[model samples]
Target: MQKKNNYHFETRAIHEGETGDGWSGATLPPIFQSAAHYHESAESLSKTFAGETQDHIYMRLSNPTNRFLEQKLAALESGAGAVATGSGMAAINNACMTLLRSGDEFVASRSLFMSSYTLFTTIFKKYGIRVRLVDPLNLDDIEQAINEKTRFVYMETITNPGMEIADIKQIAQISHTKGIPLMIDNTLASPWLCRPIELGADIVLHSTTKYLSGHGGALGGVVVDAGNFDWTRERFSDFAPFVEQRGRLAFLHRLFKEIHVNFGTTPAPLHSYLTAIGLNTLGLRMERHMENAIRVADFLKDQPKVEWVNFPGFEDHGCHEMAKTQFCNKGFGAMLTFGLKDQAACFKFIDHLDMILNIANLGDCKTLIIHPYSSQYISFSPALKNKLADPQLLRFSLGVEHAEDICNDVAQALEAI
Candidate 1:
């Protein structure tokens, strides 16, 4: 309680993963880049492979650097343990593949990151798995989507681009009553803003490529297990061997052994190291990011050329109250969406920007702007694109830059349009 009231996010981000690498008194974990490990004896190596001991056998399995980041992430998210992966989508893929079967189904929020929507509709669909999309704001819609065969319920801490927030506590309750785990994609609401597990989510996933690696040079993802889900139900028959062996670690064990190793989505040690360095400043970055978002959102709303602005920080926003409570009233988030006249106006604004980069990425220390309707959601049907946001919507990822400078740039760009 003391730490939670203090700058716990900052304290935990820097201190939680410090187990002392032993050889060097270095402050941060050193990167374990080698692909192979030489054990003292054949029996020791054999024991590692047999799961009798916890040791790094190969880079494909684990690394000290990746484990360091995983530990820090687990601590920050209040999770039981964490597994790092090559990309955010890799984290989602591995976690879902671990829990789902061929004939199983799952319920998900209609407002999802573009790639996630594709993976659920296409890849999972190809495997004979079904995904039911529903409005996360409606408890009845979420409840109706879950049937007997539903394996889990998936949602985002905050919907990407859509700027929607779920009632996680109530949603978790609904999922629990049906004997299912609630998985949340917490990439946008990084632990500094919200820890989904503390709100009753059973699993949390992140794209460390974003806020966790604030500089945007690293690409990584992670899965944080709360280790509080009921995995012994008969419906989880496939988890029998894993449960019998690992008990509380059944999900982690199966994730590492069956899917992660064979799928080969291992994160590079350098990526983990870079993410760790960025994570140390996460609390700081998030504070400025949220502040700047509010300044920018307030500035954009009054612009004459701007058609509409959607930021949960605004009291009139549909999710404002929910976001307020979920984020502990700290701030809404660093992301917001505003619409222009049309696609042409969006392009004109982008061409006029001086400092902000026109990129397909978000959650950077450097502000980024993207037109999802034409870029990220380009391949989607017209109706689907509009469903997520207006055809002329511009998604802004506020950085730690001076709010005045950012507003000035935005003002000049709108004038150019």
Candidate 2:
């Protein structure tokens, strides 16, 4: 959120991506649901294929509606540009595939979301791309982990289930010292809370299915490039062609041209349109989400049956000061996990909830609850599961509902235990 720093956040969120319909001049973006765009002349179509014009050749390559969403996402993240993908996992695949070669290796956070952890350790490993995982809070260990084989440094702005906040500014410095770009998964913090690029990240990622959609009605992802990284360096020699042609937009160009299109991680125009609409109310929703979260976290901390509440919002948390500084004190976040006596108690409590859903998803307008140990990482070994976070904890993604109502539901659920 740097170059767009001149505009107020709320104003940009609603206005930045809006390119009205050509025929109707509609205020909202019109979904271009066609499979391909036809031009009157071959020269016109040829120019677009040659990358001379920004016309839509095919839906898989681009769409007018998706462009609007991409623009708003880039502006919200203060990036040079952004590219949309079919899903969050697709976004990660496109990004890592764009840079990592067979022999290359990268460093990532140990407390990653389960899918990301599996992708890094399993699929990428099968392809001969190794990942070195480290604790998010260990800055010294992170700095030491980098070496000649490291291509880039990656981490989540806020760890998903763990809800840990790492120092983005310091970590960015560390990555830059090794002449590697820093990639941040900003899905949890959302742009309303923090923008990693302005703090020093070169690339930012988001799962629009989460806070960006706010309503949890869309499933999409975006990759935003800061245009601040130097791809002309010898280490990034593969990007030489893109740097020469696309200049500062080299990463975005390679992403769309080589990875996203060929890999077929294209998002539907309807999802883009709905996400664009949902984005308009992000600022308001995030505030209410945060307020409700603090109220809920505080309530859980005092419960006799609850063993512990793990939320960075509280001052007792080790990362509290860093989260306060990083998020500019907006509020810690809307996600938290609290422990019960055991996993069985967690399941019993979840079964008794009246309003909160037991769905696997998070960041929904309707409050969601899940027992991480049994559901999210059920296949993981006991040691690895505990290493990430407490296996007995119940994760909560608080909604915009009233604080009193959310607390009351928790009270009733606790009584069942």
Candidate 3:
């Protein structure tokens, strides 16, 4: 059956990646585990090497399993194409390296994932790429920060453990006005909750290792190009190489053929295989995650010992309204961060959790909790880290567990604190 563009997300999630092979007729996509494919003829090899034909020549450049995941994600995100990477940071790094040059600027939200902030401050800056941090909630701040050298505006759909929602459309509009593209990390707000591309973003990214996989077993990331931004636009001279060669698909085409392949950041076929299976149940899992999260947030908000809670679904949250406008009716997301009485209480709560896992990761089938100051933000300087990550903050990632049971576990943990 031919697929339609108007297909619902739930349907697309399962059907988009499956391509039945002529010989096997296998319902499941078999991992193309080999490292290389032999070219049938010199003409075919020339076509493939010259980009005249889109065939897998080397696993480092492309793999059938990775391509399936890429196709499915591209369809789900409403993107023109996608590139999968070995890890989430690789996706961000490659995107920056491909689009930015020395002295080029990119605006980003201040309260982003710690690793991203570190990437901007330590890594990207080392290459002379400048990162300008701004308040994500302020449109004026975004406008003021952008200048002629600006290449893109980047932010998370929902700020990491902070759980603050961003006005994606507003930001995208601001970026477009300046001939800059808006790039969003939609890891926390997977397409099931919010489709960033449809909200006016040019590039949507993900750490598929998280919720998309629903399991902590694999590590992978993807960058999906919305095909909205015109690379031919004169401001992006960095894109000249691709346009001079590959035309419209300049950015993604070069990214896949050069930066991704040459840098050796390709996603493994095995990881793609597992992520594909995980995506099959994303809709069902996200629903349960939303349900459990809301219940947990509501329960946390009422506790006398808790100092503050930040969940976009909460009326008291800074971006509750923005979240309501941007996300599907399923509530903000499955993630939230709350403050306890103090640092001591935070550790006590985390250490006492019975059912929830205390690992540093989020977006899992089993509930996960962590003290950001120690786990996720450990690499930063003490004073600066405190500014970025509150010492008393506890980040919670709701899972597909029973709400009541999850609530009870949180309650018991709080009581112990």
Over 1-417, each residue of candidate 1 has an lDDT whose tens digit, in order, gives 123425567877876776544537887788877998889999999999987887889999988889889988998899989999999999999999998889999999999999999999998999999999999899999999999899999999889888999999999999999999999999998999999999999989999999999999999999999989878987787899998998877887788889999999999999999999999899999999999999999999999999999999998999999999988999999999998999999999999999999998999999999998889888888887777656688999999999999999999998987
Each prediction's TM-score versus the true structure: 0.97, 0.97, 0.97
Positional deviation of residue 276's Cα in model 2 after best superposition, in angstroms:
0.4
Model 1 residue 331 CA deviation in Å: 0.8
Q: State the lDDT of candidate 3 residue by residue for 226-312, as single tens digits.
A: 887888887977678878886766888877767898999998899998898899889889988988889999998898989988888
Please give the clash total of every predicted structure, in order. 0, 0, 0
- Candidate number with greatest lDDT: 1
Q: Which 10-residue window of candidate 2 scores lowest in summed lDDT?
A: 1-10
| Model 3 root mean square deviation, Cα atoms | 1.4
Local accuracy by lDDT, each model: 0.91, 0.90, 0.87
lDDT of 1 at 167: 94
TM-score of 3: 0.97
Off by over 4 Å in 1: 1-7
**Residue pair clashes in candidate 2:** none
Q: State in Å the error of residue 380, model 1.
A: 2.2
Model 2: how far is 147 from its true place, Å? 1.0
